[model samples]
Target: MGNLMEPSSASVYDGNLASDRVVIHVTSHQRIDQQILVKWRTKTFIARIVEDQEEWIPQFLTQAANFCGENVSRGSPKGSLGSGTTLRFWIDTWLEDKPFYLLFPDLFKLESYKGCLVKDRCTGGGEFSQWEWSWIRPPSTPMEIQQLLTMLTKIQNVTLSNQDDSWRWNADSSSCFTVKSMRIRLQNASYGPTHWVFPWNKFAPHKVNVLGWRIKMNRIATADQLAKRNISTTLSLCPICKAQNETAEHLFLLCPFVDYLWSFILSWCRVSTQKPCNLKDLMEVHQKANLNHWTQKLFQHVILSYIWVIWKTRNDSIFLTKNPSLRRAIKDLKGTSFFWLATRSNIPDLNWEKWRTFSF
Candidate 1:
């Protein structure tokens, strides 16, 4: 072995020389140390020293640049964009700059303003919409909301519509009339006790439902139940005649009493048609008939009056009250029909003498 601490000198060596072998090993170790120093320096450089620096700084700079560009484009004042007086900016810088006044000249006109404000003050503007407009301000005290609503409703009756033309209602008219009328009737303060036969609370669109409830209250099984004894869907025995089966067709339309009344009315109206057997078939025929508005209204009112009189007469007989004569029933129907027609503003100029001449 060569002296371990002695510097190895460059010299040509035999292939098996030990000193040559030692020199080669020393050179290899030095090269490894130099590589390690280079690696350490590369890792310690400031660019790579901080964790996440390379990843986060570029993103932050890019966002900052974009924000600055946006601020410059909008001509924003020299402060944080989010820290400005938002309401002031909106009113002054945005709204004031628009030409809205020029485009909507009538919008600020006194007449238009009066109309808009009048609607707000009037009744029938629902509570929610009224509240939104601040027309009817929020109540400050407990139960004030209810009190205000009540007062508003009461005032509605006197100021709801044009008194001279009470029947007229345009689309823009206040809904006060309808609402107040309904509320008073529902409270039963306006109409008398004699008018309270129909249960207004339970009344709905379905005629059968109304009649069914009435039937239930009387504790009488419908004709359908009687028919079930013989496995039939139809009840065959006229409630009025007792000579004919009480099918809906016979009871409402084809019975002799009803047929005679209907025939008289049709002849008076100067219209002719085959008689219908049921309510549905009657309605279908009426739909096909080409009648003018006044005639149609007269016919409808007549039909309603007839039905009402018949039902009332039936109830009277069942309750053992004074039984209705055919003549009396017809008289009541005609009077009621005429009263309803006269109330409508657009009643036709019929031959009043001819109608009055017809004996009930």
Candidate 2:
């Protein structure tokens, strides 16, 4: 079965391919740290903008703003308009979880001062406070008049404090930012493939099951995947066949060498095998075979073992400069499945003899 904890890889990219392979997997903790770091960066960037008042902003900070803005508007890190010195009157999301410009586009067009803050329009403090709107001309159209009246009604119960505006983290019950809360929120927001749920084989080891899941999710670090992550690599072609650029799909399912290995394994299992179009299809191919439930599950386990062996061999080819041998891979696949069944599975009296002949 797959572990309750998911695997995450963190790497600092230099130029070297070998250096890029130094990954750290810390289960859920690392992802939580990453999410917290993003929030912290956004908070820092906003603070700097308020204090420094810099004219030139960096591209990364702009990205942070957009990321923060989207999440903030979702009512997580919601801003409360107190004195509203820090929030823009028209742009910042202060009222009704949206900016005034978005709520009243026609009225916003007629505003004489576009850069006015929330504090700029409030006439007085406390419950008697009123909005002092500045317009280039008075509202003439029906839509503009209606929008103004609606906006006024929204702020009718206003109670402005002398204190400055503040942001509240609504992701948690306490309205405070914590790594655990943020991580849970992020986990809830996480999505997977709509069509398939990962079939965790109880017979396979966790690492092997994880490998199969990664292959299905296309999360493996093949050349194409690395390129997509903007990591430069010297090698692009498959180490085994030296024919096509390495990808999860190509390496696991579509590669000619892998196809032959699958044929060998399936033939050994006494199952009629047809080449699957993708990793998802490959994972489910055992179900199409005419076998008993025990044999079907065992067939699925063997498939995962085969995939794990292929990946191990591929890694060997890349790192040790070892040639990929079909015999060695099949041998490794057999050994792995044998160990898994003997130790992990409920298959009674499983031995190497029965395993080799598909007698179990």
User: Which candidate has the highest lDDT of all?
Assistant: 2
On TM-score, the leading prediction is: 2
What TM-scores do the predictions have?
A: 0.33, 0.54
Which window of 10 residues has the lowest lDDT sum in candidate 2?
11-20
What TM-score does candidate 2 reach?
0.54
TM-score for candidate 1, residues paired by index:
0.33
C-alpha RMSD for every candidate: 38.5, 14.8
Instruction: List ranges where model 1 is wrong by over 4 Å.
Output: 1-222, 225-237, 321-324, 344-360
**How many angstroms is residue 7 displaced in model 2 relative to the true structure, after the best TM-score fit?**
34
- Which digits, one per residue and each the tens of the lDDT, describe model 2 over residues 1-360? 011122222110111112111122324763455455555664454444433442212222223333534442243444577776766678666666556787899999999998897878886765576889899999989999999999889888765777867555455566544434434554444334453677789999999889888888888999998999999988999998999988888888889998889789877988886778888888888888888887889999999998889889999999999999998888999998899888996777778999999985
lDDT for each residue of candidate 1 in 83-200, tens digit (9 for 90 to 100): 1222111111212222222222332231223223223344443332122123234464545555445544533432222221111111113311121221222233222223233322
What is the C-alpha local distance difference test score of each model?
A: 0.39, 0.70
